[model samples]
Target: MRRGAGIGAIRNREMVQAKYKEKGAEMAETQMATLSRQLAQLRTSLESFAAKHGTKIKNDPEFRGQFQAMCSSIGVDPIAYSRGCWSEALGLGEFYYHLGVRIIEVCMTNQKRTGGILPLNELVAQLNATKSSYASEISTDDVQRSIKKLRCLGTGFMLIHLAGGRTLVQSVPGEMSMDKTSVLGLAETHSGQTTMSLCCQEFGWSEDRARTALNQLVQEGMSWVDDADPTGERVYWFPSLFQAVRSSG
Candidate 1:
Protein backbone atom coordinates (compact mmCIF):
# COMPACT_ATOMS: atom_id res chain seq x y z
CA MET A 1 0.00 0.00 0.00
CA ARG A 2 2.89 2.41 0.79
CA ARG A 3 4.57 1.65 -2.56
CA GLY A 4 1.35 2.40 -4.42
CA ALA A 5 1.03 5.67 -2.57
CA GLY A 6 4.60 6.67 -3.47
CA ILE A 7 3.93 5.80 -7.12
CA GLY A 8 0.82 7.98 -7.07
CA ALA A 9 2.93 10.88 -5.67
CA ILE A 10 5.49 10.52 -8.46
CA ARG A 11 2.76 10.53 -11.10
CA ASN A 12 1.25 13.69 -9.61
CA ARG A 13 4.64 15.45 -9.68
CA GLU A 14 5.13 14.48 -13.28
CA MET A 15 1.72 15.89 -14.17
CA VAL A 16 2.60 19.20 -12.44
CA GLN A 17 5.91 19.48 -14.29
CA ALA A 18 4.24 18.78 -17.61
CA LYS A 19 1.66 21.49 -16.98
CA TYR A 20 4.40 24.02 -16.16
CA LYS A 21 6.31 23.12 -19.32
CA GLU A 22 3.21 23.55 -21.47
CA LYS A 23 2.58 26.99 -19.93
CA GLY A 24 6.19 27.99 -20.51
CA ALA A 25 5.96 26.97 -24.15
CA GLU A 26 2.80 28.99 -24.57
CA MET A 27 4.48 32.05 -23.09
CA ALA A 28 7.46 31.62 -25.37
CA GLU A 29 5.27 31.39 -28.44
CA THR A 30 3.36 34.49 -27.43
CA GLN A 31 6.56 36.44 -26.95
CA MET A 32 7.86 35.36 -30.33
CA ALA A 33 4.65 36.51 -32.03
CA THR A 34 4.89 39.91 -30.36
CA LEU A 35 8.52 40.23 -31.39
CA SER A 36 7.71 39.34 -34.98
CA ARG A 37 5.01 42.01 -35.15
CA GLN A 38 7.36 44.61 -33.69
CA LEU A 39 10.03 43.71 -36.23
CA ALA A 40 7.60 44.24 -39.10
CA GLN A 41 6.77 47.68 -37.78
CA LEU A 42 10.45 48.50 -37.57
CA ARG A 43 11.05 47.44 -41.17
CA THR A 44 8.24 49.66 -42.44
CA SER A 45 9.74 52.60 -40.59
CA LEU A 46 13.20 51.93 -42.05
CA GLU A 47 11.82 51.64 -45.56
CA SER A 48 10.12 55.01 -45.21
CA PHE A 49 13.33 56.51 -43.91
CA ALA A 50 15.27 55.08 -46.83
CA ALA A 51 12.77 56.46 -49.33
CA LYS A 52 13.12 59.90 -47.85
CA HIS A 53 16.91 59.95 -47.72
CA GLY A 54 18.40 57.25 -49.94
CA THR A 55 19.60 59.49 -52.75
CA LYS A 56 21.06 62.03 -50.39
CA ILE A 57 22.79 59.23 -48.57
CA LYS A 58 24.09 57.76 -51.83
CA ASN A 59 25.25 60.97 -53.43
CA ASP A 60 26.80 63.09 -50.71
CA PRO A 61 30.12 61.64 -49.66
CA GLU A 62 30.33 63.69 -46.50
CA PHE A 63 26.78 62.76 -45.58
CA ARG A 64 27.44 59.09 -46.29
CA GLY A 65 30.57 59.22 -44.13
CA GLN A 66 28.70 60.99 -41.38
CA PHE A 67 25.90 58.47 -41.56
CA GLN A 68 28.35 55.58 -41.23
CA ALA A 69 30.01 57.45 -38.39
CA MET A 70 26.66 57.92 -36.72
CA CYS A 71 25.94 54.23 -37.03
CA SER A 72 29.26 53.61 -35.32
CA SER A 73 28.33 56.11 -32.62
CA ILE A 74 25.15 54.23 -31.75
CA GLY A 75 27.07 50.97 -31.50
CA VAL A 76 25.12 49.58 -34.41
CA ASP A 77 26.03 48.32 -37.82
CA PRO A 78 23.51 50.21 -39.98
CA ILE A 79 23.69 47.90 -43.00
CA ALA A 80 23.33 44.87 -40.79
CA TYR A 81 20.45 46.47 -38.99
CA SER A 82 18.69 47.28 -42.23
CA ARG A 83 19.31 43.85 -43.74
CA GLY A 84 18.49 41.94 -40.58
CA CYS A 85 15.21 43.72 -40.07
CA TRP A 86 14.15 42.74 -43.57
CA SER A 87 15.29 39.13 -43.37
CA GLU A 88 13.94 38.12 -39.95
CA ALA A 89 10.36 39.23 -40.30
CA LEU A 90 9.77 39.42 -44.05
CA GLY A 91 11.07 36.03 -45.17
CA LEU A 92 12.59 37.78 -48.18
CA GLY A 93 15.75 36.54 -49.82
CA GLU A 94 18.68 38.92 -49.18
CA PHE A 95 19.30 39.55 -52.88
CA TYR A 96 15.63 40.34 -53.52
CA TYR A 97 15.44 42.58 -50.47
CA HIS A 98 18.49 44.60 -51.41
CA LEU A 99 17.42 44.71 -55.03
CA GLY A 100 13.99 45.84 -53.93
CA VAL A 101 15.49 48.66 -51.90
CA ARG A 102 17.60 49.74 -54.86
CA ILE A 103 14.56 49.64 -57.15
CA ILE A 104 12.64 51.83 -54.76
CA GLU A 105 15.49 54.28 -54.62
CA VAL A 106 15.54 54.43 -58.40
CA CYS A 107 11.81 54.98 -58.51
CA MET A 108 12.11 57.69 -55.91
CA THR A 109 14.71 59.35 -58.08
CA ASN A 110 12.00 59.91 -60.66
CA GLN A 111 8.36 59.00 -60.37
CA LYS A 112 7.85 59.36 -64.11
CA ARG A 113 10.87 57.18 -64.76
CA THR A 114 9.00 54.58 -62.80
CA GLY A 115 9.22 51.11 -64.38
CA GLY A 116 12.03 52.20 -66.68
CA ILE A 117 14.97 51.06 -64.61
CA LEU A 118 18.51 52.29 -65.16
CA PRO A 119 20.85 50.03 -67.06
CA LEU A 120 23.56 48.06 -65.23
CA ASN A 121 26.32 50.10 -66.84
CA GLU A 122 24.91 53.46 -65.82
CA LEU A 123 24.27 52.26 -62.30
CA VAL A 124 27.85 51.00 -61.96
CA ALA A 125 29.14 54.26 -63.35
CA GLN A 126 27.23 56.12 -60.69
CA LEU A 127 28.46 53.83 -57.91
CA ASN A 128 32.07 54.07 -59.13
CA ALA A 129 31.81 57.81 -59.42
CA THR A 130 30.41 58.02 -55.93
CA LYS A 131 33.10 55.64 -54.70
CA SER A 132 35.87 57.68 -56.33
CA SER A 133 35.27 60.83 -54.34
CA TYR A 134 33.92 58.90 -51.41
CA ALA A 135 36.93 56.57 -51.51
CA SER A 136 39.03 58.82 -49.35
CA GLU A 137 36.22 59.09 -46.84
CA ILE A 138 35.11 55.47 -47.18
CA SER A 139 37.67 52.78 -47.81
CA THR A 140 37.37 49.88 -50.23
CA ASP A 141 37.46 47.68 -47.14
CA ASP A 142 34.33 49.36 -45.88
CA VAL A 143 32.58 48.88 -49.23
CA GLN A 144 33.64 45.24 -49.35
CA ARG A 145 32.53 44.78 -45.77
CA SER A 146 29.18 46.34 -46.54
CA ILE A 147 28.88 44.16 -49.62
CA LYS A 148 29.58 41.05 -47.59
CA LYS A 149 27.04 42.11 -45.01
CA LEU A 150 24.49 42.91 -47.67
CA ARG A 151 25.05 39.50 -49.21
CA CYS A 152 24.42 37.90 -45.82
CA LEU A 153 21.24 39.93 -45.66
CA GLY A 154 20.44 38.43 -49.10
CA THR A 155 20.98 41.62 -51.08
CA GLY A 156 23.40 41.59 -54.00
CA PHE A 157 24.94 44.29 -56.24
CA MET A 158 26.54 43.74 -59.63
CA LEU A 159 29.60 45.40 -61.16
CA ILE A 160 30.12 45.20 -64.89
CA HIS A 161 33.38 45.93 -66.70
CA LEU A 162 33.15 46.94 -70.31
CA ALA A 163 35.75 47.33 -73.02
CA GLY A 164 37.59 50.69 -73.25
CA GLY A 165 38.22 50.88 -69.51
CA ARG A 166 34.69 51.39 -68.26
CA THR A 167 32.97 49.70 -65.34
CA LEU A 168 29.22 49.69 -64.85
CA VAL A 169 27.39 48.96 -61.62
CA GLN A 170 23.69 48.47 -61.03
CA SER A 171 21.18 46.97 -58.68
CA VAL A 172 18.41 44.63 -59.79
CA PRO A 173 14.89 45.61 -61.06
CA GLY A 174 14.87 49.10 -59.64
CA GLU A 175 17.51 50.35 -62.05
CA MET A 176 17.66 48.19 -65.16
CA SER A 177 17.20 50.74 -67.97
CA MET A 178 15.62 49.28 -71.07
CA ASP A 179 16.42 52.00 -73.58
CA LYS A 180 20.18 52.39 -73.32
CA THR A 181 22.55 50.24 -75.33
CA SER A 182 25.00 48.21 -73.27
CA VAL A 183 28.55 49.03 -74.34
CA LEU A 184 29.32 45.34 -74.55
CA GLY A 185 26.31 44.93 -76.89
CA LEU A 186 26.01 41.43 -75.46
CA ALA A 187 22.66 42.32 -74.02
CA GLU A 188 21.61 43.53 -77.45
CA THR A 189 22.91 40.54 -79.39
CA HIS A 190 22.18 37.52 -77.23
CA SER A 191 18.59 38.22 -76.12
CA GLY A 192 19.40 38.40 -72.41
CA GLN A 193 20.75 34.86 -72.24
CA THR A 194 24.52 35.43 -72.21
CA THR A 195 26.74 34.53 -69.26
CA MET A 196 28.18 37.45 -67.31
CA SER A 197 31.50 35.71 -66.82
CA LEU A 198 31.84 35.27 -70.57
CA CYS A 199 30.97 38.92 -71.10
CA CYS A 200 33.53 39.96 -68.47
CA GLN A 201 36.25 37.82 -69.99
CA GLU A 202 35.38 39.15 -73.40
CA PHE A 203 35.47 42.70 -72.03
CA GLY A 204 38.51 42.22 -69.75
CA TRP A 205 36.73 42.95 -66.46
CA SER A 206 37.90 41.68 -63.08
CA GLU A 207 36.32 38.26 -62.61
CA ASP A 208 34.96 39.02 -59.15
CA ARG A 209 33.32 42.26 -60.21
CA ALA A 210 31.89 40.67 -63.32
CA ARG A 211 30.39 37.82 -61.36
CA THR A 212 28.69 40.16 -58.93
CA ALA A 213 27.37 42.31 -61.79
CA LEU A 214 26.09 39.26 -63.62
CA ASN A 215 24.27 38.03 -60.55
CA GLN A 216 22.63 41.40 -60.16
CA LEU A 217 21.68 41.40 -63.80
CA VAL A 218 20.11 37.99 -63.41
CA GLN A 219 18.11 39.17 -60.46
CA GLU A 220 16.91 42.26 -62.33
CA GLY A 221 15.76 40.33 -65.44
CA MET A 222 18.27 42.03 -67.68
CA SER A 223 20.00 38.64 -67.92
CA TRP A 224 19.25 34.98 -67.36
CA VAL A 225 21.06 32.26 -65.43
CA ASP A 226 22.82 29.79 -67.70
CA ASP A 227 21.22 26.42 -67.01
CA ALA A 228 23.89 24.82 -69.15
CA ASP A 229 26.54 25.71 -66.59
CA PRO A 230 26.31 23.59 -63.44
CA THR A 231 27.85 26.51 -61.57
CA GLY A 232 24.95 28.93 -62.39
CA GLU A 233 26.83 31.69 -64.18
CA ARG A 234 24.56 34.52 -65.45
CA VAL A 235 24.26 35.62 -69.06
CA TYR A 236 22.73 38.84 -70.42
CA TRP A 237 21.24 38.86 -73.91
CA PHE A 238 18.95 41.83 -74.07
CA PRO A 239 15.73 40.02 -73.36
CA SER A 240 14.08 43.40 -73.13
CA LEU A 241 16.08 44.73 -76.04
CA PHE A 242 15.19 41.74 -78.18
CA GLN A 243 11.54 42.19 -77.46
CA ALA A 244 11.82 45.78 -78.57
CA VAL A 245 13.82 44.76 -81.62
CA ARG A 246 11.25 42.15 -82.49
CA SER A 247 8.49 44.70 -82.23
CA SER A 248 10.46 47.07 -84.46
CA GLY A 249 11.44 44.34 -86.92
Candidate 2:
Protein backbone atom coordinates (compact mmCIF):
# COMPACT_ATOMS: atom_id res chain seq x y z
CA MET A 1 0.00 0.00 0.00
CA ARG A 2 2.86 2.37 0.79
CA ARG A 3 4.49 1.65 -2.57
CA GLY A 4 1.20 2.30 -4.34
CA ALA A 5 0.73 5.52 -2.38
CA GLY A 6 4.24 6.70 -3.30
CA ILE A 7 3.57 6.01 -6.97
CA GLY A 8 0.34 8.00 -6.75
CA ALA A 9 2.27 10.90 -5.15
CA ILE A 10 4.83 10.70 -7.91
CA ARG A 11 2.11 10.82 -10.53
CA ASN A 12 0.45 13.74 -8.71
CA ARG A 13 3.73 15.65 -8.60
CA GLU A 14 4.26 15.08 -12.32
CA MET A 15 0.75 16.29 -13.07
CA VAL A 16 1.36 19.46 -11.04
CA GLN A 17 4.67 20.05 -12.75
CA ALA A 18 3.08 19.54 -16.14
CA LYS A 19 0.40 22.08 -15.29
CA TYR A 20 3.02 24.61 -14.24
CA LYS A 21 4.98 23.99 -17.42
CA GLU A 22 1.91 24.58 -19.54
CA LYS A 23 1.18 27.79 -17.63
CA GLY A 24 4.73 29.03 -18.15
CA ALA A 25 4.56 28.28 -21.85
CA GLU A 26 1.28 30.14 -22.15
CA MET A 27 2.73 33.16 -20.37
CA ALA A 28 5.77 33.16 -22.65
CA GLU A 29 3.62 32.97 -25.73
CA THR A 30 1.48 35.86 -24.52
CA GLN A 31 4.56 37.98 -23.91
CA MET A 32 5.93 37.15 -27.32
CA ALA A 33 2.67 38.10 -28.98
CA THR A 34 2.62 41.43 -27.17
CA LEU A 35 6.20 42.19 -28.20
CA SER A 36 5.52 41.24 -31.79
CA ARG A 37 2.53 43.51 -31.96
CA GLN A 38 4.52 46.38 -30.50
CA LEU A 39 7.27 45.85 -33.05
CA ALA A 40 4.73 45.77 -35.85
CA GLN A 41 3.25 49.06 -34.69
CA LEU A 42 6.70 50.65 -34.51
CA ARG A 43 7.46 49.46 -38.04
CA THR A 44 4.21 50.90 -39.30
CA SER A 45 5.06 54.27 -37.73
CA LEU A 46 8.53 54.24 -39.27
CA GLU A 47 7.11 53.45 -42.68
CA SER A 48 4.71 56.31 -42.37
CA PHE A 49 7.53 58.65 -41.42
CA ALA A 50 9.63 57.55 -44.36
CA ALA A 51 6.79 58.05 -46.78
CA LYS A 52 6.05 61.52 -45.49
CA HIS A 53 9.64 62.73 -45.62
CA GLY A 54 10.62 60.87 -48.75
CA THR A 55 10.84 63.94 -50.94
CA LYS A 56 13.07 65.89 -48.54
CA ILE A 57 15.30 62.89 -48.10
CA LYS A 58 15.59 62.41 -51.83
CA ASN A 59 16.29 66.05 -52.69
CA ASP A 60 18.58 67.21 -49.87
CA PRO A 61 21.78 65.32 -49.25
CA GLU A 62 22.05 66.42 -45.62
CA PHE A 63 18.50 65.42 -44.90
CA ARG A 64 18.93 62.17 -46.79
CA GLY A 65 22.00 61.32 -44.68
CA GLN A 66 20.06 61.97 -41.51
CA PHE A 67 17.20 59.79 -42.69
CA GLN A 68 19.60 57.03 -43.55
CA ALA A 69 21.12 57.30 -40.11
CA MET A 70 17.71 56.99 -38.54
CA CYS A 71 16.88 53.95 -40.63
CA SER A 72 20.16 52.36 -39.62
CA SER A 73 19.41 53.01 -35.97
CA ILE A 74 16.27 50.96 -36.37
CA GLY A 75 18.10 48.17 -38.21
CA VAL A 76 16.49 49.14 -41.49
CA ASP A 77 18.02 49.60 -44.92
CA PRO A 78 16.08 52.22 -46.83
CA ILE A 79 17.65 51.36 -50.15
CA ALA A 80 18.22 47.66 -49.83
CA TYR A 81 15.45 46.63 -52.19
CA SER A 82 14.77 47.72 -55.74
CA ARG A 83 11.14 46.93 -55.24
CA GLY A 84 8.54 45.87 -52.66
CA CYS A 85 8.68 46.85 -48.96
CA TRP A 86 11.43 49.45 -48.91
CA SER A 87 10.48 50.81 -52.30
CA GLU A 88 6.86 51.34 -51.31
CA ALA A 89 7.79 52.72 -47.92
CA LEU A 90 10.46 55.22 -49.00
CA GLY A 91 9.42 55.88 -52.61
CA LEU A 92 13.09 56.52 -53.53
CA GLY A 93 13.87 53.05 -54.77
CA GLU A 94 13.67 53.90 -58.45
CA PHE A 95 16.13 56.75 -58.13
CA TYR A 96 18.82 54.61 -56.48
CA TYR A 97 18.11 51.69 -58.77
CA HIS A 98 18.59 53.83 -61.86
CA LEU A 99 21.69 55.40 -60.37
CA GLY A 100 23.16 51.97 -59.67
CA VAL A 101 22.68 50.96 -63.31
CA ARG A 102 24.45 54.11 -64.44
CA ILE A 103 27.27 53.46 -61.97
CA ILE A 104 27.75 49.96 -63.38
CA GLU A 105 27.88 51.37 -66.89
CA VAL A 106 30.43 54.00 -65.92
CA CYS A 107 32.60 51.47 -64.13
CA MET A 108 32.52 49.04 -67.07
CA THR A 109 33.40 51.72 -69.62
CA ASN A 110 36.46 52.77 -67.59
CA GLN A 111 37.43 49.33 -66.25
CA LYS A 112 40.54 49.04 -68.41
CA ARG A 113 41.86 52.42 -67.37
CA THR A 114 41.00 52.18 -63.66
CA GLY A 115 41.65 48.47 -63.05
CA GLY A 116 38.20 48.31 -61.41
CA ILE A 117 39.08 50.84 -58.72
CA LEU A 118 38.42 54.59 -58.69
CA PRO A 119 38.22 57.26 -56.06
CA LEU A 120 34.77 58.16 -54.80
CA ASN A 121 35.26 61.85 -55.52
CA GLU A 122 36.49 61.15 -59.02
CA LEU A 123 33.51 58.92 -59.67
CA VAL A 124 31.08 61.55 -58.47
CA ALA A 125 32.72 64.21 -60.60
CA GLN A 126 32.57 62.00 -63.66
CA LEU A 127 29.00 60.97 -63.03
CA ASN A 128 28.05 64.59 -62.67
CA ALA A 129 29.83 65.63 -65.82
CA THR A 130 28.36 62.80 -67.81
CA LYS A 131 24.85 63.00 -66.36
CA SER A 132 24.32 66.72 -65.96
CA SER A 133 20.55 66.58 -65.48
CA TYR A 134 20.89 65.65 -61.81
CA ALA A 135 24.50 66.65 -61.27
CA SER A 136 23.84 69.79 -59.29
CA GLU A 137 21.99 67.88 -56.57
CA ILE A 138 24.00 64.67 -56.53
CA SER A 139 26.27 64.06 -53.55
CA THR A 140 28.67 61.39 -52.33
CA ASP A 141 26.09 60.18 -49.85
CA ASP A 142 23.62 59.58 -52.66
CA VAL A 143 26.23 57.76 -54.70
CA GLN A 144 27.20 55.59 -51.74
CA ARG A 145 23.61 54.64 -51.06
CA SER A 146 23.15 53.77 -54.70
CA ILE A 147 26.30 51.66 -54.69
CA LYS A 148 25.13 49.80 -51.60
CA LYS A 149 22.16 48.65 -53.63
CA LEU A 150 24.48 47.42 -56.37
CA ARG A 151 25.86 44.70 -54.09
CA CYS A 152 22.69 42.70 -54.61
CA LEU A 153 23.72 42.06 -58.20
CA GLY A 154 26.76 40.08 -57.00
CA THR A 155 28.93 42.09 -59.38
CA GLY A 156 31.54 42.57 -56.65
CA PHE A 157 31.00 46.30 -56.28
CA MET A 158 32.73 47.47 -53.12
CA LEU A 159 34.16 50.52 -51.40
CA ILE A 160 37.78 50.48 -50.22
CA HIS A 161 39.30 52.71 -47.57
CA LEU A 162 42.65 54.38 -48.23
CA ALA A 163 45.29 55.89 -45.92
CA GLY A 164 43.84 59.38 -45.75
CA GLY A 165 40.21 58.82 -44.85
CA ARG A 166 39.58 58.55 -48.57
CA THR A 167 37.31 55.95 -50.13
CA LEU A 168 37.35 54.40 -53.58
CA VAL A 169 34.97 52.26 -55.51
CA GLN A 170 36.29 48.83 -56.43
CA SER A 171 34.21 47.08 -59.07
CA VAL A 172 36.52 44.19 -59.82
CA PRO A 173 36.98 40.80 -58.19
CA GLY A 174 40.48 40.28 -56.82
CA GLU A 175 42.45 41.27 -53.76
CA MET A 176 45.09 43.89 -54.50
CA SER A 177 48.63 43.16 -53.33
CA MET A 178 50.11 45.46 -50.68
CA ASP A 179 52.83 46.78 -53.01
CA LYS A 180 50.28 47.52 -55.70
CA THR A 181 48.00 49.26 -53.22
CA SER A 182 50.88 51.34 -51.89
CA VAL A 183 51.90 52.30 -55.40
CA LEU A 184 48.36 53.40 -56.21
CA GLY A 185 48.15 55.36 -52.97
CA LEU A 186 51.41 57.12 -53.83
CA ALA A 187 50.18 57.87 -57.32
CA GLU A 188 47.01 59.43 -55.91
CA THR A 189 49.10 61.80 -53.81
CA HIS A 190 51.03 63.06 -56.86
CA SER A 191 48.18 63.91 -59.24
CA GLY A 192 48.00 60.33 -60.64
CA GLN A 193 51.54 60.23 -62.03
CA THR A 194 54.55 58.71 -60.29
CA THR A 195 58.11 58.24 -61.54
CA MET A 196 60.85 56.05 -60.11
CA SER A 197 62.58 59.03 -58.53
CA LEU A 198 59.37 60.26 -56.92
CA CYS A 199 58.59 56.84 -55.45
CA CYS A 200 62.16 56.50 -54.13
CA GLN A 201 62.14 60.01 -52.69
CA GLU A 202 58.66 59.82 -51.17
CA PHE A 203 58.63 56.25 -49.85
CA GLY A 204 62.37 55.48 -49.56
CA TRP A 205 61.95 52.59 -51.99
CA SER A 206 64.68 51.31 -54.26
CA GLU A 207 64.52 52.17 -57.95
CA ASP A 208 64.06 48.53 -58.88
CA ARG A 209 61.31 48.12 -56.28
CA ALA A 210 59.36 51.10 -57.60
CA ARG A 211 59.88 50.10 -61.20
CA THR A 212 58.76 46.52 -60.56
CA ALA A 213 55.60 47.64 -58.80
CA LEU A 214 54.79 50.22 -61.51
CA ASN A 215 55.41 47.70 -64.28
CA GLN A 216 53.12 45.16 -62.66
CA LEU A 217 50.36 47.76 -62.47
CA VAL A 218 50.96 48.66 -66.11
CA GLN A 219 50.78 45.03 -67.16
CA GLU A 220 47.54 44.63 -65.25
CA GLY A 221 46.08 47.70 -67.01
CA MET A 222 45.70 49.59 -63.75
CA SER A 223 48.05 52.30 -64.99
CA TRP A 224 49.27 53.86 -68.22
CA VAL A 225 52.85 54.31 -69.39
CA ASP A 226 53.67 57.89 -70.28
CA ASP A 227 57.07 57.29 -71.91
CA ALA A 228 56.36 60.24 -74.09
CA ASP A 229 56.44 62.51 -71.05
CA PRO A 230 57.81 65.94 -71.87
CA THR A 231 60.59 65.46 -69.28
CA GLY A 232 61.69 62.15 -70.85
CA GLU A 233 61.13 60.35 -67.54
CA ARG A 234 58.84 57.32 -67.58
CA VAL A 235 55.72 58.47 -65.74
CA TYR A 236 52.96 56.09 -64.72
CA TRP A 237 49.46 57.42 -64.11
CA PHE A 238 46.58 55.75 -62.35
CA PRO A 239 43.98 56.19 -65.08
CA SER A 240 41.03 57.01 -62.80
CA LEU A 241 42.88 59.85 -61.16
CA PHE A 242 44.30 61.04 -64.45
CA GLN A 243 40.82 61.03 -65.95
CA ALA A 244 39.56 63.31 -63.20
CA VAL A 245 42.49 65.65 -63.65
CA ARG A 246 42.00 65.71 -67.39
CA SER A 247 38.31 66.48 -67.00
CA SER A 248 39.00 69.41 -64.71
CA GLY A 249 41.68 70.73 -67.02
Please list the residue runs of candidate 2 whose C-alpha ends up more than 4 Å from where it truly belongs after superposition. 1-42, 81-86, 112-115, 129-136, 196-213, 227-234, 246-249
Q: Write the per-residue lDDT of candidate 2 for residues 10-63, one digit (tens) a residue.
A: 999999999999999999999999988977687677677777876677677788
Worst 10 residues of 2 by lDDT: 80-89
Question: Which digits, one per residue and each the tens of the lDDT, describe model 1 over residues 96-125?
Answer: 344345443642453232123334434333
Would you estimate the TM-scores of all the predictions? 0.33, 0.68
Residue 122 in model 1: lDDT: 41
TM-score of 1: 0.33
Candidate with the greatest TM-score versus the true structure: 2
Where is the poorest 10-residue window by lDDT in model 1? 110-119
